[model samples]
Target: MLEIKDVAFGGKAVGRLEDGRVCFSPDALPGERVQVTVTRETKRFVEAQLDRVLEASPRRVKPPCPYYGACGGCSYQHAAYDYQVELKTKQVGDVLGRLGGIENPNVLEGVPSPLPYGYRNRITVHRHGGRIGFHRRDGKGLVDIEACLLASDEVNKRLAELRRERFHEGARVLREHASRMGFHQTNDGVGALLQDAVSEACGSGGCLIDAYCGDGFFAHRLAKKFQRVIGLEWNERSIAQARSVAHANESYIEGDVAARLAEVLEEADGAATTVILDPPSQGLDVQVADLLRAYPVAKIVYVSCNPATLARDLKSLAAVYELGSATPFDMFPQTAEVEVLAILRRRF
Candidate 1:
């Protein structure tokens, strides 16, 4: 059995074994004395599971979810909401300070979800044989979930209906397609909220270019505020859907964003422009960064999932632009993940 010592980097407790090796345990908070059974002893660190609480931390509370321990959806649902926010804030600060080499970075308070429970717009439910739910945290076993507290009511309702039907290969395709279309209610209406933030930041009557604008989610909304809105997307299926819903004035081009940006810039020709980038987690390529720097855009709104990559790209862009403000959105509550939107303006 191991005793909890202090909070480690990834929200786990760091403890040492008698043999002079380190160990880590989940569900074991800092300042709590717990007896943990060693599950696996590795060369560097040992993995353990909580066996008994010799002494529980005051921050510990009853987990609301029925499948808290088994389901991989959430980790901190066992802790109180306020404490969860505090932990997340610390995580963001730590990553930026330690990894990004940014000292005492001003991490704005995280934007809280409108409704913590039942706020997810999308949920990918796994299916193998008759089982349909999330995979177990440790084992290959599947935990069949009838109701998910974090998923929207629409997803839960659709899941219930889908379960009644016999499992077929075609059902998986249909479910996956539906989930990607954003049919469920999300926290703070994520799509609308992002669009509103962009609009407010950009102000009225200017050309706006969106990169990786999936299904015209933000482009459609920005069309109302901008004089002209152009969206670049690679997915033909998403482009088709976007075209179907796109406003008459809004234009969407189906191609690589990096390749199309040059053409868009040539066409715009020094018109007041604002670029909104929502790239993948790997972050923008060097070529893309080069093109963005070359373009005479007035401002850039970079939305990123990985802060490490964001910091790298921001350093590159810092040659021409100055950091304005950063706002973090808690899209994923449980894990060590956060979505941040940073606004950058030309230094001149």
Candidate 2:
């Protein structure tokens, strides 16, 4: 038996074996004693499979979904909604402090989803042989699911329709929300809160440079706050969509952000500029960091889905910028995935 002390960033509860080796188990919670069998072992840590809950936590609750343990889609169904948010909030702070090398990072409480279950606007299911559903929790094969508890009603209805039809061995994406533009957030409720945070961070700037501005998600909404708004992205399709609803003050360029950012930064006044970075899961490129350091902006609002990469990028910019606030958005509620908005200001 091991006492689970904390939940790690990647959705595993951390505990220590009798020999002092760190162990990770997915179906366990903090403050609980669990009996586990080691599945994989490394020099640094051990991965274990939870066999039984020796001492259950108060936060543990009956999972509503019948396929909760079998399906790989959701992890926190057995945990209370508020406790899930609390665990994720701590996970963000832990990752930032450990990986980013920031002492006592300013991490705010996680913003809870309006509806924990039935919040997902879309769900992707795979079909293999006779099974048609998501991958198993162990990831060895598919687990046939009648319906997904995390998916919205409309998405579930489409899923039901897909179940009746026969398809080749592949994946099917059922979505309720429609976006003509590219790369919109999956959770619409939390997505609006995310935009609000970004807008607040970009308060009253003269020039706004939105890097990796897919479909001008922020650029279009925040054009009125700045005298000039420039959006940089590589996707031509997204740029076209952004251009279709272009504000008078907004100008979008279709090119690599690292290649074109310097040219725009050279012309904009550094004191009056606020650059918004909504990079991919890998975070900002090294060249992009170098350019930002060379040409410092007044403020930066970085939006990231992966906390580890976000921490690394924040550390890279620590020399020129000071951390203002870090807010966690529970965009993907049931899973361990978290979205963070980090605000930074040029150091005096």
Candidate 3:
């Protein structure tokens, strides 16, 4: 018997097995009593597959998608959308306290996305065994899907066209961007809220140095608010596009920000600046944090998707900067993914 006490960060239920070993059961909800079959086991913990829910929580609901359990697309489909946000908010606070060594950090409730369903602007589907669809929960095999509920209507129509066009490649990618299919927010509606949150965190002033800035999304808007804006990205195509629309005060540089950050800071010449970091899911290196520590940058507005690495980075940065409240945004609903925006002001 397993008593699911709470839900973990990756959409698994935190529970203890009969042998007192901590067990995680996938596709589970908190407050549920269940019998599980152990799939994998370690010395400290065990991973189990859900067998049967002897007692279900009131918040547990029937999943909307037919392939909810099989397809790796949606993890929280069995959870109510409001409950999903609540779990994510709690998870963010837990990580901040446990990993970041922050005692009772100011963490606000997660902001829900404007459109939860049908919000993804891009997706890459796999083609295997005559099935053109997504990967399974284990991320090994393909799950044949007729349609994806998370994709936009335009993307779904394109999926249908791809099926009819005999485009039976190993994978099919869907993108909303006109120029090139690169990295952009899958949920653009919530992305606006993220931009607003970052802007609010920075509070309108100083040089906006947008690291990993793609197509000048944040830098262009902040150029008017600041004396100058510098966007650094490795993508040459995105840099070209950004340069084409650059204002007189805005400049986009095509290079690795990490290598050129010190040079850029030297050029800034001790001006008040906010270094905006929107890194990938892998977070950033300790060297980046070290540079921020040595530099005189006034503020840092960090946008992150992975909390574990975010906590690690914040812990390192805490020695130099004063940590502020962390705000989470539900950029991807019905999934384990959560977007977090954290602000750190320089300590005197």
Candidate 4:
């Protein structure tokens, strides 16, 4: 028996064994006394599965999604939405304080999604038998589903269409609404809020250079605030879309940000320029970090989906930059993924 003390970053909770060994138990909540079966053991800590919850937390709730526990998509559906936000905020502060080496970081309260359910604009469904749905939590098979509770109505309609018409065995299909197509934010409501947060912190600068600027999202939003706005992305399709509606003040470049960062920064003319970097889950490239060290951009607004990668990048940037604030946005409810925006200003 162990007492779960806190919520971890992933789908796990903190606990301690009788001998004072740190234990991480899954499918349990904080303040719960759980009987755990040890699944994995390391010198530093032990991993476990919740055999039974002898005591449950007040924050625990019945998951709304029928496929909550079986489907591989969601993790925190068992917890209340407000508790989910609190857990995420604490996780962000913990990661920054320990891994990022930022002591007593200014971590603000997490911003919750306007609509916790039916907000996802995209979902990947796999063919199971004659039907299409998500994979099982164990990854052994697929779970047939009629409609996902996390997708938008438009997306659900598209999913219905996809269910009626499809081909190939074990084929994975991405069904999306015709209007919101291809690699856009899944939670537009939360995205709009995140964009506003970034824009408010972006302060007045000579220019803005957007890196990993998918479809010129932030670039187009803050174009009016800067004299010049240039966005760099690796995807040709995204770049094409960005250029299709490019304004007189905006320029979209097709190339890796690390390879083309110098060219984009040249337009800044060594003045006060804000560099906006929204990298992928893998975080920044080594080339990008080295270049930033060499060039030392005056200001940076970094948006990331993976806290581990974000912490790693921030640790490197701390040498020449002063971290302002780190804010977490509960972009995805019932899931472990968290979106964070970090503000930085150069020390020199």
Cα RMSDs, all models: 3.6, 1.4, 1.5, 1.7
How many residue pairs clash in each candidate at the backbone level? 0, 0, 0, 0
Off by over 4 Å in 4: 128-131, 170-176, 179-182
Instruction: Give all candidates' CA lDDT scores.
Output: 0.74, 0.90, 0.85, 0.85
**Local error of candidate 4 at residue 39 (angstroms):** 2.5
Q: Candidate 4 at 212: error in angstroms? A: 0.5
Residue pairs with clashing backbones, model 1: none
On residues 290-336, what C-alpha lDDT tens digit does candidate 1 reach at each position? 88777767888887777778777877776777667766766666555
lDDT of 2: 0.90
- What tens-digit string does per-residue lDDT give for candidate 3 at 1-348? 788998989899889876788999887888889989999999989999999999998998898888888998888988888999999999999998899898997888899998879998888888888888998998778998778999888888877877777765598787766456446778999999998888777766668889888888778878788888998899988888889889999988888877878778877744488889998888877667788888868888899999888888889988888778789999999989999998888877
Q: Which parts of model 2 have CA positions greater than 4 angstroms off?
A: 179-181
Say which candidate scores most in lDDT: 2
- The stretch of ten residues in a row with the least summed lDDT in candidate 3 is 174-183
Name the TM-score of candidate 4. 0.95
Which pairs clash in model 3?
none
TM-score of 3: 0.96
The TM-scores, one per candidate, come to 0.82, 0.96, 0.96, 0.95
